[model samples]
Target: MEPGAETLYAYANRRRREITEGVNGGSGRIVPVTIAAGTFPFPIDATTRNAIASAATATTLAGGDAYTVPSWLLPTGRFITLDATAIVVVALAISVAFQAVFSAQAAAFAGIADGSVTTHEAVDAILGS
Candidate 1:
């Protein structure tokens, strides 16, 4: 049989046991999902590159739904009329990474800007060398 592409997932954070007998309102448990294997990285293909180029302009043009760009990236769906791929790629590059925009930081400071890493080699979308 052909496995084709096997996605082996190992979940890191799991609540072994809930809050004991009489706990307060919220203990503040969070579901953390760290990709054990590589997943959707900053797409480097020609198509993705072109999309990002277009979005780069849109980002500035359609600024300040909240004034400042957030640190942890997630598409706001603010630019749905525009190209989705472009917006996502551009956003991932700019706001998702650890360092400033496109700094080639590695070793303790790896991010989407590190061209050396790829989906196959990376454990996470942004990783430290």
Candidate 2:
């Protein structure tokens, strides 16, 4: 996991570069794909295909808190809250901070706020082969 915001920023930038600007002098090539989802025919465009492929790695980063990013991003301790209602609020804030920071970096890399990389279920749905 990334030890801090700087490392996380670097990793996301690297991932974006690898996908968008590879060795071929900037003119990106389309990968041929055939998708059969069900009785209905599914034809995925290049942007969608790229997003779907990237989602595999992206979702892992998305679930940063569950995957233990809080260890690196936040202070170590059990979250304490006297108010019962505020307990969920406090916990969600800490976890969501870890998630939102990483995901926001991804959005900036892609030049849009369209990352569908939220959970493992999302990746499975988008990238199941």
Best by TM-score: 2
How much does candidate 2 score in TM-score? Answer: 0.24
lDDT of 2 by residue, 1-129 (tens): 313434444555554343333334432222322222111111132343343334433434555323221221111223221222222233333334334434645454343224434433333232222
- Where model 2 places Cα greater than 4 Å from the true spot, the runs are 1-81, 111-129
lDDT of 1 by residue, 1-56 (tens): 31111121110001111111112433221212222221223423233344555565
Per-prediction TM-score to the true structure, in the order listed:
0.23, 0.24
* Highest lDDT scorer: 2
The regions of model 1 sitting more than 4 angstroms off are 1-39, 66-129
Residue 29 Cα positional deviation in candidate 1, in Å, after optimal superposition: 35
Worst 10 residues of 1 by lDDT: 8-17
TM-score of 1: 0.23
